[model samples]
Target chain A: MGKKIVLTSGKGGVGKTTVTANLGIALSMLSKKVALVDGDIGLNNLDVVMMVENKIVYDIGDIAEGRCRTKQALIQDDCFPSLFTLPSAKTMDNSRIPPRVFVSIVNELNQDFDYVLIDCPAGIDEGFHRAVAGADEALVVTTPHISAVRDADKVVSLLSTYCMKAVGLVVNRLKGNLVTEGATMDAPDIAKLLRVPLKGAIPEDEEINLSSQISKCKDKSSARLAYLLLASYVDGKDTKVFDCASDYRGFFKKLQRVFR
Target chain B: MLKNNTILRLKRILLSDKVNMPSGLIQLLKKDLLKLFDSYFDIKEESLKIEIDSNADGEYDVSIKGVSERIKSPRFMR
Candidate 1:
């Protein structure tokens, strides 16, 4: 069976879906068959991030209601044939989907893909419970902001109750210049505060914000590199963390920073 | 300077009892426990109290205190 990992953030708008989409594609780039499942239910939008929203016909609700086969609901990525996404129901209520049903769906996906990445909805409510029902591991995503890190701390404590096989952290939207100038918390420090191992740290990049509209990030973007590094770690190949502050540390960069 | 302040504030927030215990959740837990314990013991609903604490390792330490006047008959046990 493949590994089932849920990407979650206790607070919303922390780039959980973006990380799921990009990480899924990166895993596919590594030649691993990956599945992305949107667990957001009524507010589902992983399809939009993956740029397969138009192709989705049968959603997770359809599969649970026996209206469609599991394979019928999975939409293959156009750019990466190895990556497939199962979109959540845009109209279905989250409470209507039982945790066991989501578990079974993820179990089914595990048989076909090397990695099953579930994009968890924000907050520790019914949606959160259902999203994490079948996962062996969790990746908590947070920004460098204090509020985001505080929410992440609560999430880490809650995940401990779930007895997850492993819990990792992904720090997103890290402003490199702010960290180098001591204006904001560092990504690794946030991970340390949450007591979760740092799996990835993505520097703040406009490419990521644009990737949502364009369906894929530029190949040369630093966000893409960080995601690839994260994927390599997930694949058990490497442990090198991306240096988010590297660009702003040099003497010449400091001069540029003054003008920036 | 700002990062250090953030770290200090986060430590205080994480260490606070409100964040760790969440009184509202504990109330709900007590309600359920009351129902379960009432099956075998003659105890008042308000008699149950639960305390939860997280240590340095992030592990929860939970303790429940209650008083029961007597146990129900074996025939009534469920």
Candidate 2:
């Protein structure tokens, strides 16, 4: 059995799905058997983000309700041979899932995969509870915004209450310009506010949205680098914290040399 | 109910912590408050006071006087 990790945020649109998709790809690239479980029932987006929407014949709701076997709901990624997806049902409401059922599902996945990554829906509601029920650890995703940080704090508290073995944070959509201008929160600030160790930070990247929308993950974009670093951390590797300003400087320096 | 121990632990962590309401909730509250008092006042939702400042004396004071145009400054005759 492998570790089960839930990626969650209390606020919506903080890139939980994006993190889950890219992390699955990154882990699979490292030769790990990874499964991304979409826990956002009635509003499934992981499949779309992963560009496997048409391949999903069954979903988590089906398995939870005994409509289909758990294995029957698993969808393999077209791009990565080791990556799989257990998509959430777009038609079913989140209330249909009992906490025990979700836990059982995660335990079953743990038996077959190196990692079971649950992409939780936003809010501290039933979906959030179901997503984290059987996880070995959690990654609380937040943005630089104060509201997102506050919600992330609540999530950290909830995870602590459950006595989860490991709970780290991933701050997504960070703007380097804003951080330098002192107009936005930085990784250290978020870590202090949430009182959790930082897993990784993803800078604001337009390419992430573009690539995901086009179903392409081959781009060596900042978002991809962020995901790779996050996966490396999860796999017990110590990747340095991404310094966005320094990264920009190196990129521009290389560009200038190339042009010269 | 959250247990006494849990509450105490939460108090230790959250004591004197001031959490501002989300912009969405703040907007909704401003709209509701305006609707309730719209007959007598004009209100600016963005300027509305939504935070309660906690003092070292353990007393929290909520200021809502700055939210509306109806609130007038005390006139002083020089």
Candidate 3:
């Protein structure tokens, strides 16, 4: 069965949705069937990030309420084969899903894909619980700031109880220069501070701001490579870990090596 | 977005990668984390520019909001 993993953050606006969408697309690019679940419920935003909001016919709410079948609501990408998004309901209905329902939906998705990435909402509320209840693992996304790291630590501690398999960290918006200058926390420092395994680190990108209108990003974009590296890591690939500092240095080195 | 060789490298790793974390499983922490966030946001709502809009897609999309919009916390230093 494909892995059922939830991407969560304790605080809001930490790029959880961006990570989920890119990871799903990148995994599917490897020909692995990937399904993305918007676990935010009432405040569903994954569809917008994936650019499938208008395509959502039957949401998880409909499936939970027995109004529609599971497969009916899936929004498959025409360009990216084997990639699908199970969007959350945009309405204000009670977004609280029972644990059994959440598990059932994830289990059903797991049967058909190589990976199921759940986009968990910020905050440790009922919505967050329902999102994490059905996952085999959890990936907590955060920045290098003190508040973000503090919340991330709690997320790791919280997932220790719910995530059956393991809990990992994806340090997003890492500015290597800032860390080097002591302006922000570094990736390894955040991992050690939270006591969670470091799965991936994403460099901050301006392109991510424009991604909501268009569902895709440039292939060579820093955020794209970071997310692809993350997808590779999640797939158990031994690819070289992403080096944010090398973002500038490595580019020139590769160019020099090519000429040599 | 990975090169063909990079994808192959990933496939080889997947042959043995099982989503293992160094701190795999531990005693559950429950709402202990929630308490920490609540206290941090408790008396700082005024200085903190918190925004939670569901319709900000294609703009703030997944959330151009959260705590990243210039709300530096003072507790980390103290």
Candidate 4:
């Protein structure tokens, strides 16, 4: 079986889908066969972000219901050969498929792919329960807000109850300027509150939003860099956490400060 | 904003990667305990302290003080 990972957060609109899409792409770029599963059920957006919204004919619900085979539902990415997506059903509600069935599907997919990344739905409801079922690890996504952090704390406590060994955090849509200006919580604050080891922090990048909307890829953007670093870390490569506060300040200025 | 920042910074330093009980939960527990023993004794919510020891063995100790005269009398126990 392959690595089954669930990316989840308790709060909504915190970019869970965005992280799932880009991280799948990033993992594929590292030469791993990746299957991105959209676990949001009725409100699927991973396919849209991957630019394969029009390509999905069969979804996870179809396979779960025995209407189609797993391979029949898998959508191959046009840009990344190693990447595939199991889009969630738009018509079905979150509770239509049982959590046990979702676990079995992930277990089956794990045999074929190197990484099965489940893009979990927001909230601590049935959708979230189904998303994290039978996953090998979890990536708890959160923003720098107090509510998001509190929600993440709840999720982390849940993960602990499930006895999941590997759990890390990814702070998304972080603005360095906001942190420096005292308008936002820093990464350390989030890590402390969430009680998880820090995995990566995705900087607030305008290009990521633009690219997702226009369906045109951009190069070496902040989000891309963050995703790449996250993928490398997941692949067991040693990578430093991106220092948003210092990185926003030019590298030369940071270097000068270090030397001085 | 500066005050908020300072509070956040202090929280980051003091409570990093630690799960402390939320104040709301503490208050709720206090309220429930007060209601349970309201007739026998006066439960002082403000004087109750819940502490978890940091040693190898995970043990929690709850200390409640400020008992009323009725509960303090030796004849009341037996």
TM-score for all models, in order of appearance: 0.80, 0.74, 0.72, 0.77
Return the lDDT, model 3, position A247: 40
Question: Of the candidates numbered 2 and 4, which has the greater DockQ value?
Answer: 4
What is the model-wide C-alpha lDDT for candidate 1? 0.86
lDDT for model 3, please: 0.72
Error of 2 at A33 (Å): 0.6
Give Cα-based local distance difference scores for all models. Answer: 0.86, 0.77, 0.72, 0.78
Q: For model 2, how does the per-residue alpha-carbon lDDT over B1-78 read when each residue is reduced to its tens digit?
A: 222333323332343334443435445766777666565556665555544444667575554554565743333421
Q: What shift in Å separates residue A218 of candidate 3 from its native position after superposition?
A: 3.0
Question: Residue B10 of candidate 1: its Cα lDDT?
Answer: 68
Q: Which candidate is the best by lDDT?
A: 1
DockQ, 0 to 1 scale, candidate 2: 0.04
Best-matching candidate per TM-score: 1
Interface RMSD of each: 0.9, 13.5, 13.5, 4.9
lDDT string, candidate 1, A1-260, tens digits: 89999999899999999989888988998999999999999999899888888998899999999999999999998888999999999998777789999999999999988999999999999999999888999999999877888888888888999989999999998988899989888878987777789999988888778665223666666688888899998888998878889878989867865665
Location of the lowest summed lDDT over 10 successive residues in candidate 4 chain A: A212-221
Report lDDT (Cα) of residue A114, candidate 4: 92
Say which prediction, candidate 2 or candidate 3, comes out ahead on lDDT: 2
A best-first ranking of the candidates according to their DockQ comes to: 1, 4, 2, 3
Off by over 4 Å in 1: A213-215, A252-260, B17-78
lDDT of 4 at A138: 96
Clashing pairs in 3: none
- Could you give candidate 3's per-residue lDDT for residues A56-99 as a string of tens digits? 77999888889898899899987786999998877846544676
Clashes of each: 0, 0, 0, 2
* Span of ten consecutive residues with least summed lDDT in model 1 chain A: A211-220
